[model samples]
Target: MHASDTVDEQLELAADLPPWEKLASKARALKVMEEANKIIEDFPTWEYWVFFLLFMTEFFLAVYVSINLLK
Candidate 1:
């Protein structure tokens, strides 16, 4: 059988396994995992970015208000 057939077979088998087993199979299969890990490692987490945005926006708003108040 070809590679595609092998993948199909694995998928069919996975369907019969437990939910965690399905996740384990993909986690163990590292074909696309290196890139996925790279992305995970490179990006700041969601919480950090959200806080950064709020802080920057607050800073800018304070500055604008200060300028307008003085005029």
Candidate 2:
């Protein structure tokens, strides 16, 4: 093969390498973001307070009904 042909092949190989590296980096970053989002979603927050309030309300209602039944 000629010198120019070898240089062209080298350039093509270099060009291909960078795009693969960039795609891999992007995939890694996306995976990290997805994991972070899952962690955030799993965590209990103010929503837990709302659930606690509802549970308390139900417990009070049950107690009230039981007391009235006893009377």
- TM-scores of the models, in the given order? 0.44, 0.43
RMSD of 1: 9.4
Name the weakest run of 10 consecutive residues (lDDT summed) in model 1: 1-10
- lDDT tens digits by residue: candidate 1, 1-71: 23233444555667878989876655544434555668779999899999999999999999999999999
lDDT of 2 by residue, 1-71 (tens): 22223333444445556777655655555566667778889988998999999999999999999999999
Error of 2 at 22 (Å): 0.3
The clash count of every prediction, one per candidate, is 0, 0
Off by over 4 Å in 2: 1-17, 49-71
Highest-scoring model, lDDT: 1
lDDT of each: 0.70, 0.68
Listed per candidate, the RMSD to the true structure in angstroms reads 9.4, 14.6
Q: The CA-based lDDT of model 1 is what?
A: 0.70
